[model samples]
Target: MKQLPPEYYALLEELQAVDFVLVELTLYLDTHPHDYDAIQQYNQFAQQRGLLKKQIESKFGPLQQYGNSYSGYPWNWDDAPWPWQV
Candidate 1:
Protein backbone atom coordinates (compact mmCIF):
# COMPACT_ATOMS: atom_id res chain seq x y z
CA MET A 1 0.00 0.00 0.00
CA LYS A 2 1.11 3.59 -0.65
CA GLN A 3 1.99 5.80 2.29
CA LEU A 4 0.92 9.42 2.68
CA PRO A 5 3.35 12.25 3.34
CA PRO A 6 3.73 13.87 6.76
CA GLU A 7 2.54 17.13 5.32
CA TYR A 8 -0.60 15.27 4.33
CA TYR A 9 -1.55 14.83 7.95
CA ALA A 10 -0.73 18.45 8.73
CA LEU A 11 -2.74 19.62 5.77
CA LEU A 12 -5.59 17.33 6.70
CA GLU A 13 -5.67 18.75 10.21
CA GLU A 14 -5.70 22.26 8.82
CA LEU A 15 -8.36 21.32 6.29
CA GLN A 16 -10.54 19.91 9.07
CA ALA A 17 -10.24 23.05 11.16
CA VAL A 18 -11.01 25.21 8.16
CA ASP A 19 -13.95 23.02 7.30
CA PHE A 20 -15.37 23.47 10.77
CA VAL A 21 -14.93 27.22 10.65
CA LEU A 22 -16.61 27.32 7.25
CA VAL A 23 -19.52 25.21 8.42
CA GLU A 24 -20.02 27.29 11.54
CA LEU A 25 -19.92 30.52 9.63
CA THR A 26 -22.32 29.10 7.06
CA LEU A 27 -24.82 28.31 9.80
CA TYR A 28 -24.37 31.68 11.41
CA LEU A 29 -24.76 33.40 8.07
CA ASP A 30 -27.99 31.59 7.47
CA THR A 31 -29.48 33.58 10.32
CA HIS A 32 -27.41 36.72 9.85
CA PRO A 33 -26.57 36.92 6.20
CA HIS A 34 -25.77 40.57 6.41
CA ASP A 35 -23.36 40.25 9.30
CA TYR A 36 -20.16 41.83 7.94
CA ASP A 37 -17.94 40.50 10.73
CA ALA A 38 -18.92 36.91 10.18
CA ILE A 39 -18.57 37.24 6.44
CA GLN A 40 -15.12 38.75 6.76
CA GLN A 41 -13.93 36.08 9.14
CA TYR A 42 -15.24 33.35 6.89
CA ASN A 43 -13.50 34.84 3.88
CA GLN A 44 -10.25 35.02 5.82
CA PHE A 45 -10.37 31.42 6.88
CA ALA A 46 -11.39 30.28 3.42
CA GLN A 47 -8.38 32.02 1.94
CA GLN A 48 -6.18 30.34 4.52
CA ARG A 49 -7.47 26.96 3.46
CA GLY A 50 -6.76 27.80 -0.16
CA LEU A 51 -3.20 28.69 0.68
CA LEU A 52 -2.68 25.45 2.56
CA LYS A 53 -4.16 23.47 -0.29
CA LYS A 54 -1.79 25.09 -2.74
CA GLN A 55 1.15 24.33 -0.51
CA ILE A 56 0.18 20.69 -0.32
CA GLU A 57 -0.26 20.43 -4.05
CA SER A 58 3.06 22.09 -4.73
CA LYS A 59 4.88 19.70 -2.46
CA PHE A 60 3.01 16.53 -3.28
CA GLY A 61 1.85 17.15 -6.85
CA PRO A 62 -1.75 17.73 -7.84
CA LEU A 63 -4.01 15.52 -5.76
CA GLN A 64 -6.05 14.62 -8.80
CA GLN A 65 -3.04 13.97 -11.01
CA TYR A 66 -3.25 10.37 -9.93
CA GLY A 67 -1.36 8.96 -12.92
CA ASN A 68 1.95 10.29 -11.64
CA SER A 69 4.34 12.53 -13.62
CA TYR A 70 7.58 11.31 -15.17
CA SER A 71 10.06 14.03 -16.11
CA GLY A 72 12.59 15.02 -13.48
CA TYR A 73 11.51 13.64 -10.14
CA PRO A 74 8.76 11.08 -10.46
CA TRP A 75 5.63 12.26 -8.67
CA ASN A 76 5.37 9.08 -6.72
CA TRP A 77 1.86 8.76 -5.42
CA ASP A 78 2.58 5.06 -5.01
CA ASP A 79 5.85 5.53 -3.13
CA ALA A 80 5.70 8.99 -1.53
CA PRO A 81 6.40 8.14 2.10
CA TRP A 82 3.67 8.24 4.75
CA PRO A 83 2.40 11.30 6.56
CA TRP A 84 4.57 10.49 9.57
CA GLN A 85 7.60 10.46 7.29
CA VAL A 86 7.37 14.04 6.11
Candidate 2:
Protein backbone atom coordinates (compact mmCIF):
# COMPACT_ATOMS: atom_id res chain seq x y z
CA MET A 1 0.00 0.00 0.00
CA LYS A 2 1.15 3.50 -0.73
CA GLN A 3 1.84 5.83 2.16
CA LEU A 4 -0.73 8.55 2.75
CA PRO A 5 -0.02 11.91 4.25
CA PRO A 6 -0.81 12.44 7.94
CA GLU A 7 -3.69 14.76 7.14
CA TYR A 8 -5.47 12.06 5.22
CA TYR A 9 -5.24 9.66 8.14
CA ALA A 10 -6.37 12.36 10.53
CA LEU A 11 -9.47 13.18 8.51
CA LEU A 12 -10.27 9.50 8.12
CA GLU A 13 -9.92 8.97 11.85
CA GLU A 14 -12.23 11.86 12.63
CA LEU A 15 -14.85 10.56 10.22
CA GLN A 16 -14.56 7.06 11.69
CA ALA A 17 -15.14 8.41 15.17
CA VAL A 18 -18.26 10.23 14.03
CA ASP A 19 -19.52 7.10 12.31
CA PHE A 20 -18.97 5.04 15.46
CA VAL A 21 -21.05 7.45 17.53
CA LEU A 22 -23.79 7.37 14.90
CA VAL A 23 -23.91 3.58 14.97
CA GLU A 24 -24.19 3.52 18.74
CA LEU A 25 -26.94 6.11 18.70
CA THR A 26 -28.78 4.15 16.05
CA LEU A 27 -28.67 1.00 18.16
CA TYR A 28 -30.02 2.89 21.18
CA LEU A 29 -32.78 4.48 19.13
CA ASP A 30 -33.78 1.07 17.83
CA THR A 31 -34.90 0.11 21.35
CA HIS A 32 -35.94 3.55 22.63
CA PRO A 33 -37.38 5.17 19.58
CA HIS A 34 -38.63 8.20 21.45
CA ASP A 35 -35.33 9.21 23.01
CA TYR A 36 -35.30 12.73 21.73
CA ASP A 37 -31.86 13.57 23.06
CA ALA A 38 -30.30 10.54 21.39
CA ILE A 39 -32.17 11.28 18.18
CA GLN A 40 -30.79 14.81 18.12
CA GLN A 41 -27.28 13.57 18.78
CA TYR A 42 -27.60 11.09 15.96
CA ASN A 43 -28.64 13.84 13.57
CA GLN A 44 -25.70 15.97 14.61
CA PHE A 45 -23.27 13.12 14.04
CA ALA A 46 -24.82 12.36 10.68
CA GLN A 47 -24.31 15.95 9.59
CA GLN A 48 -20.72 15.88 10.80
CA ARG A 49 -20.13 12.73 8.82
CA GLY A 50 -21.46 14.33 5.66
CA LEU A 51 -19.26 17.39 6.07
CA LEU A 52 -16.23 15.25 6.80
CA LYS A 53 -16.91 13.19 3.71
CA LYS A 54 -17.05 16.30 1.60
CA GLN A 55 -13.78 17.55 3.03
CA ILE A 56 -12.06 14.26 2.36
CA GLU A 57 -13.35 14.12 -1.19
CA SER A 58 -12.30 17.67 -1.93
CA LYS A 59 -8.81 17.22 -0.56
CA PHE A 60 -8.03 13.65 -1.48
CA GLY A 61 -10.70 12.07 -3.66
CA PRO A 62 -13.80 9.88 -3.69
CA LEU A 63 -14.15 7.41 -0.86
CA GLN A 64 -16.18 4.97 -2.91
CA GLN A 65 -15.55 3.34 -6.26
CA TYR A 66 -18.84 4.79 -7.57
CA GLY A 67 -21.10 7.65 -6.52
CA ASN A 68 -21.83 11.40 -6.81
CA SER A 69 -18.13 12.14 -6.29
CA TYR A 70 -17.55 11.50 -9.96
CA SER A 71 -17.33 14.63 -12.11
CA GLY A 72 -15.59 16.30 -15.08
CA TYR A 73 -12.07 15.85 -16.50
CA PRO A 74 -10.49 12.45 -17.05
CA TRP A 75 -12.72 10.72 -14.51
CA ASN A 76 -11.10 11.56 -11.21
CA TRP A 77 -12.66 8.66 -9.38
CA ASP A 78 -10.82 6.28 -11.65
CA ASP A 79 -7.51 8.06 -11.13
CA ALA A 80 -7.79 8.91 -7.44
CA PRO A 81 -5.69 6.63 -5.29
CA TRP A 82 -7.53 4.17 -3.06
CA PRO A 83 -7.32 4.77 0.68
CA TRP A 84 -5.72 1.40 1.29
CA GLN A 85 -3.21 2.04 -1.44
CA VAL A 86 -2.47 5.49 -0.22
Candidate with maximal TM-score:
2
Residue pairs of candidate 2 with colliding backbone atoms:
none
Count of clashing pairs, candidate 2: 0
Candidate with maximal lDDT: 2
Give me the displacement of residue 45 in model 2, in angstroms. Answer: 0.4
Model 2: per-residue lDDT, tens digit, 1-86?
34568999899889889989999999999999999999999999999999998999887778875565645465665554566564
- What is candidate 1's lDDT per residue for 1-86, written digit by digit as tens? 45665767778688778979999999999999999999999999989977876776666655434344332256455555443344
Clashing residue pairs, backbone N/CA/C < 3 A, model 1: 4-82, 4-83, 5-83, 6-83
Score every model by TM-score.
0.66, 0.81
The C-alpha lDDT values of all candidates are: 0.71, 0.81
User: After superposition on all CA atoms, what RMSD does each candidate show versus the true structure?
Assistant: 5.3, 2.2
